[model samples]
Target chain A: MARVELNGVRKTYPNGFQAIHGIDVNIADGEFIVLVGPSGCGKSTLLRMVAGLETVTDGEISIGERVVNQLEPADRDIAMVFQNYALYPHMTVYNNMAYGLRNRGTPKDEIEKRVRKAADILELSEDQLARKPRQLSGGQRQRVAMGRAIVREPEVFLFDEPLSNLDAKLRVQMRLEIKRLQRSLGTTSIYVTHDQVEAMTMADRLVVMNGGRAEQIGTPMEVYERPATVFVAGFIGSPAMNFLEGRAEGGKVVVNGAAGLAAPADIPDGPVLVGLRPEHLAVVDGGAAMLELAAEAVEPLGADTLVHGRLGDGQLVTIRLSGTPTFGEGDRIALAAEAANLHFFDPETGRRI
Target chain B: MVENRPFATFVSHFVLILGVAIVAFPIWITFVAATHDGVRITQVPLPLLPGDQLFANLESAFFTGVGNAREQSVGMMLFNSLVMALMIAGGKIAISLLSAFAIVYFRFPFRMGFFWMIFITLMLPVEVRILPTFAVVANLGMLNSYWGLSIPLIASATATFMFRQVFLTVPDELLEAARIDGAGPLKFFRDILLPLSRTNIAALFVILFIYGWNQYLWPLLVTTDKSMYTVVMGIKQMLEAAEESPEWHLIMLTTLLAMLPPVLVVVVMQKMFVKGLTETEK
Candidate 1:
């Protein structure tokens, strides 16, 4: 396994379109780093640069002790699993797994042993290994793809939304399987996906990207709990963190012309964007309520109820409370969160306070 | 179609039967004419039923050959035709496949320019450039050779375009995956691209084999030697002798023998041909 480093890597298309502005990431050996973003966010481009599939255009990428910017993908000692599986359709599963070894001129017996071992690890039966990719089910094909990557035993593994083609149930199962496999193999891996849940669950550290730049890169919880920018706070969590326009003065914030909301301590006397996570809020007693919400809709999930409503200041917010909620649509509820759960951002720069 | 109207069904069956009769009548005449002696064939109100000269005509055509083209046996002419067809089909596929691979995969300078240049040759067929091609073949001393017969006809733009379409449909990820699998450009073409185009190649082979087999004018222009005469040209030579004594039975027999190899090719690879034209397997 090798640690990978991307030092100010950039990708610029020939037509003057800049897909990746500049990204610098230092990935530790055996660490699973996930590049997560929306479409056109340059996450996939960054992953392809690391895979040596796309030219770096600028900056240096090194695997182990050698700079790999000039290396071909095969010489870079990396294996990739594409979103579509990209299995060789004409070859049997065994040949698909053994193709790389054969191309590298590995001995026939050694190639067979490695392919058989990979198939065994992937739970593919002997008969299944002899069958072509089209003859296998979607999940089985996915396993064969993984087997193809595993048999190579490359220094690093690259997964480009490998599970996105599977059904929802299979996606979750494969997600767990991939995480477990990566942990056991301890290969430095870079995974790219548009799904935040996959990033949150599968990554040892997450690099949240936006507009071709790395907005925040940290452990999942660190990025979630203490977002560095307004975009990170909005993108990382489910039900998304809610934002409200408010004025900070003295030691408190004023919203809807009412000056009673508790603000974080390190605030200047200026306008600030207040962020409150949906799960951090609770239904408080009427007299103890810091914000009053007019419930517009309620989604009753089994373990939690989400109340999407407008606050007194006319800003939309969502509140997640444990168990079933007594409030329904059109019900006015009092909501409050601890001072530490609140997030403050500078309105002008979108930087966290 | 789902309604299953009786009048529509009857009309459709009648039209289909009429079409079959129109196509099959000439072949039936040829078969019947081959079964009779030349005197019986030349008789007015020609016999539609079989005569007992079938084996006699077969033996005469296979051993002695047709009248005007009798210098070389009909069997030898068939062999020459088979060689030309196979070479033309094989050579066209090889050249077209390589050209399509280069056009689709590589990003060289003037790539599309090269493709359009090849494609433009489709408008300039052999007949249009026959004199120049003949001069080149004569200058190279390839006249009276199998290479002279097939080489000028082997550069097929249609097959190249078809293979190009086939290669374009292949997902880009497969190329990327192969690159990561340590395959170089030519290795990927051999191991991945060629195998994937198997059915398409089969389909094109059937068509090109028939085209080469039916070629009459090009071989006539190139080969002055009787040994290099293809079967299609053999039939034409026999017809030219009809101005004197028309060996109708032997000529009909030669036509029947000339149809066999192409028909066998189509029948043998019918499944692959259909699949290649209709479906693209990944």
Candidate 2:
């Protein structure tokens, strides 16, 4: 219903400690933007600022072309599903779903109708709807929390780590469920999460943040394939993008005691680093200018394996390989980085070269 | 397990029975004292059974002493006590709830200092402030009236403190949800905060009810008229009315009747009170 734009928004606590350092984000109408970051990275704080839960310390926030820096959270036309669910323990699921509508002065019959409709969409049984949140399972409670938001039919749906409390399997299931729900509803949603996988899988556009600044904003694939900065490359992927410390000279990047690979670009004068994705490193027979590893350990999964090793200058690197590696701990192996997949960064500033 | 532990179970039952007896004895004493006649009550060994003197003692207790003001009857005194308790309880709860909501939900200048000041009132007993409170109420022209008797005794520091404690435990998320739901402070308190505080409300009701029902000194000082005498004061008046000999049996019986309402409320709701107290408010 609305495209929310945080134009130079900032938040500072009363004691004058700044939490958000003037963030500017423009989310299109009906866009699903995921704010992803490590803990204390100000992602949730930024989302809350958009939702108007937090007071805007400095700049303007506009939703649907109307400035709402001074608007109340409810008046902002955004419904947020909190991390703890925050279900009214005394109220039944039905009432919980109807709470927003009732507060908005919706008709008694309409509240009931909308509540029943939401309950059906959430797959809540009549019995579950009548039961208190305390009696419901965690996933069920989460659904009721979702129902509480959906019944409002707000301009934006803000989710604050909503699935963090669920079990691993439930988190995955709920993650897909939420993605499908957002797709069908097409509400402008801003979901905050620390889980990279959640951000990678669910976001239409991922806004990766660090230290109160937006690290990168793009499609998940774009962030993965072409990270603009070193932090974005490392934070977006699990086990992280491998960084090999070396110097760029004579059209080649060299790591001590390892074979040097030809640099893609004109020789960056001196200090440089090579970044490679784990999955892109194909295990080839030892030869040529490809990086050779003295494997430190091998972690095998039923589906795939991860090879952990130390680069010559001792940066920890992990490689994703298919099937259990026949190679054991401390085996000598050769890894070839797909030329297109290799990323070059300036060693001092960490900006991609 | 039952088959394996018969003797241990029997001992447990025996201990339970003793505990029950210990709890039941005070009530039992009141009942027996109510039934005994004058001479038997004053005798070395008190009457342990209901006696024929019950009706006569009741009749005198109801109809004696200082005129229609009912200084004569413990029955009139019981009515006064009930009226006073209900008023005080209702008034105390109403004031405390508002103050609690203000302090708990809203941020104001000097909010912490205000909270500390209110909490300090609890540390200072009503007994200590009775003279000053009475003076203030008297000066306000509320003496000898129901309003006078009720208002001063019913403003509770403890109720507000307890309610704030409960509000503190309520997840910040719930309040945030209500705000996002478009509720202002008034609507938020009415729809969410008040309802969620059912346990604390019950606990405060219990405390306020007992405080009002059992108050002796404040009402005694405020209501100089005999007709307005509370049940606590009524019992003291019983001795004065006894021209020849005091009817200790009648006095005890009337006291038991006066104590019933609050006693029953506590009996039924004591568990809720404890449950309310134990909450983490996290």
Clash count, predicted structure 1: 0
Clashing pairs for predicted structure model 1, backbone only: none
What's model 2's lDDT at B2?
Answer: 39
Q: What is the lDDT of residue A175 in candidate 1?
A: 94
lDDT of each: 0.92, 0.84
Output the number of the DockQ-best candidate.
1
| TM-score of the A-chain for all models | 0.98, 0.96
lDDT of 1 by residue, A1-353 (tens): 99999899999999988999888899999999999999999999988998888998999999997999999999999999999999998898999999999999999999999988888888999999999898999999999999999999998999999988899999999999999999999999999999999999999999999999999999999999899999999998999999989899986887767645777676899998989999999998998787889999999999988899998768999989889988789999988888889899999999998
Query: How far in Å is the alpha carbon of B145 misplaced in model 2?
Result: 1.8
Question: What 10-residue stretch in candidate 1 chain B is worst by lDDT?
Answer: B272-281
> Which tens-of-lDDT digit does each residue in B169-265 have in candidate 1?
9999999999999999999999999989999889899999999999999999999999999999989887776447879999998888888899999
Fraction of native contacts under 8 Å reproduced by each candidate: 0.77, 0.75
